[model samples]
Target: MVNAPSGISGEASLEDRIARKARELGFVACGIASAAEDPVRAERLEQWLGEGHHGSMEWMETRLAHRRSPQGLWAAARSVIALGMSYAPAHDPFALEEVGDHARISVYAQGKDYHDVVKKRLKALARWLVAEQPGAQVKVFVDTAPVMEKPLGEAAGIGWQGKHTNLVSREHGSWLFLGAIYTTLDLAPAEPHRDSCGSCRACLDVCPTDAFPAPYRLDARRCISYLTIEHKGPVPEDLRAGLGNRIYGCDDCLAVCPWNKFASRAAAMQDFLPRPELVAPRLAELLALDDAGFRALFSGSPIKRIGRDRFVRNCLYAAGNSGDAALVGPCEALADDPDPVVADAARWALERLTSAP
Candidate 1:
């Protein structure tokens, strides 16, 4: 076990020691940043929400002050220890796009839930940091918290928020899962990473749904990941066909980033490895999953969060776009589902499939 240094002097040494410990605990990258509110980012967020970019996820509007500023989340926090774990895929995540009638789950959701995987490590690191500084209060956050992790990560030198509105690390590409440990300790901050995404509109151009209205800004309503995952009820009529075979979170933007050339195929953590069953799930099979079967298949994965109804709704959209006769029977069966939203999506999908040339 790597031990924290005794009587560590100066901020730089302590920062180094902490970063080393984070690496020892399996984090691919680690850094620290002052725990102050970022007015610039706050303004951007306010404008984005005002424009209804958040869509049905009204939670983004709640505790607006806290979501914009780390200080609002925890007044006592003097520094934020940002950490990242790589879930880089071996092959291009977009490679499976052409596989007709197969469901394309996001690269990140192909295995275990990242919140479960990242939070455990964050807690472990927070405990170590608390022990090292005695009396220093610490709180760890994953995606569940109101904390703005991406900006904090950029401030901590982990990466820059790319045009796609997600953190882009040169070393880890667009595949890093972020976590934070807010602490009262005044740890030395790392040099902030400058935006390296200049002139690269690959992420924006690649979005199937034109989710990015501008660089570094996303209108989540049109995002396939949002439509397929966060969205409840039937998807908008015009966008269902654009969903194609994506039945979970969409990775088109992330996968197209040029920085991903540096990403490794194998994830450092075993839990992030893709499950063979989820890699290219048959639309017919996925549409037929009942609550029990859905739970069993996605036992430890993030996909289970949306439940059977939403998942099947997404699958139906894919089936509608597939133009394959094999999936028509399943779509017809689900058109009469008990869940009104699923039934609606089924009918829409069936109509599209049956109408296809």
Candidate 2:
């Protein structure tokens, strides 16, 4: 166990002590939030879901009750400790835009799976909390459960939910990986971060598919990140061109946020540094990934969960948009893919590439 700093042992409150310990444990940001229900947050979620903005993510609907509040998930959880780990990229997220032969990957998915990385640290923090105060029960979550992590993150002062419907920190911008610890102990809540996006339309304007219906409201159906990674079939034909070179996830909105100017690239952990091959992978190469090949390539990556077919489907979409005739051979090979969805995408890419002058 790492000991506290020399003079900080005399701190007045336990929350302060715990927060200091959280910093020591590698959390870039840490704050407290109550377990009580937040009516506004709940109503907003209900509205988002009611509007079908969540697209095909049915789990949000099924877990509505438990997700509305921390107490709803665990009655004994008196306070929630929100933590953020920075994965801010050290390089430009838009570097591959003109490089048509290559594919663009979201910064978040270009390295080790964040679910595993964040959860491990969350568990370690939870264990430390338990050991510090014997019998203290804690539950840690990192996007796995029904928990509404974004709103809770905002309430905990980690950052406010921006117009892109993603958390944006004044310090770290849109580069945080959030996690939470629900504990039986009642801790003083931090002041909630107010919406700082005032008059800023950068994120909204940068979205190629116009995913945002309005400021702070996203229609996931049109989001490239949702389409490439979550939508399970051939993408909507109308939106295919907008996907461009983004083969896995989209970063346009996040990359354009003015707040990102404040983010420090050096603060990013080594675990999230983009792998050399994944940094700017050739679209043709990605279009050739077989199931086993895809599995090996993305072995510890979040992209693997979407499977080879979906991945290739995305690469094909990029190929069609690439305007690079060299990808035609690879696109032709997958026109009869076993997965009907991948086959459909291949046929579509052939039409685009062949039709172009």
Candidate 3:
């Protein structure tokens, strides 16, 4: 193994210490990027934002300068340590879609929220860096921050962003959760990874909603993942049928990638293992969840963020498409739900059920 350069102390060279601690903390890959201007990246971000591709995620527009370039976040920051943790599932994620009566929650949201899991590890690494450097200042972030993690990961040599706009690692495929630690310590940077998605349009073609307007560009309004999970109000009628049983985020784009053949199931990270109930929950069962029931079911999972009303709204859409008259009772029950969004979706599902051939 290539060791850190001579004379570097405080456990070891920053890179060696970080790599060791990260491995102990369950990270699959770690890399460093020296803080510098990212003009081309800034331009691309500005263009994407100008095009309003972020949909209702208005926060993406608030910290334009800080998000596009790390130097803007912290003036003295010398390096950004990017980390990736694998959440690869043991079974094919797409297989769950065939179960007609069940809702297909995304694999990543099957267990404890990754933002919490990855953030804890990132903070641990940050703590180690502070202890080692004594005077070093560090700020750690998971997806909770305005940081452009994919681009930073690319600059740090973790992986290149695939056409689907997710970071794709050679070893972990597209099943990695990213986190970062910005520090005042100067660390040698790794060579950036090149995009290996050559000629593969599988991700784009597989989207049921045609979310991708072009390669490497996504229209969040048309994205099933965004429609089901991110959009708080009623889901658009046109996209509901295409959403099928996916009541949370959609994974068709990632599932179709050929690179996934090389992916390995993540080692037992308790936070990533699926709850038996969430694996293939019945649409009627999920639609029956009131506020308390929804809270109880998704207590530790990322799906909890959508809350009971939004979640039931999504389930209602799936119930409509399920074409199972059994689900019609649950859909009608929710038609008068207190939440307008839930009520509207239930009414729509009830209508679809009634009109079915």
Q: Which candidate number has the best TM-score?
A: 2
Q: Considering only N, C-alpha and C atoms within 3 Å, which residue pairs clash in candidate 3?
A: none
Stretches off by above 4 angstroms in model 1 are 1-12
TM-score of each: 0.95, 0.96, 0.95
Worst 10 residues of 3 by lDDT: 1-10
Q: Write the per-residue lDDT of candidate 2 for residues 1-357, one digit (tens) a residue.
A: 112233456654667677777877777888889999999999999999999999999999998999889999999999999888899998899988989999999999999999998898899889988998898999999998988888998998889999898988999999999999999997788889899999989999999998998998999999999999899977999999999999889989999999999999877777888899999998878887899999999999999999998999999999999888999999999999989999999999999999999
**lDDT tens string, model 1, 172-284?**
88999999999999877878889999898999998888888889889989999999889987899988878888989889888988898887766468888889898878888
Local error of candidate 1 at residue 151 (angstroms): 0.7
Better model by lDDT: candidate 2 vs candidate 3:
2
Number of clashing pairs, model 3? 0
Clashing pairs in 2: none
In angstroms, give how far residue 235 of model 1 lies from its true place: 0.7
Highest lDDT: which candidate? 2
Of 2 and 3, the candidate ranking higher by TM-score = 2
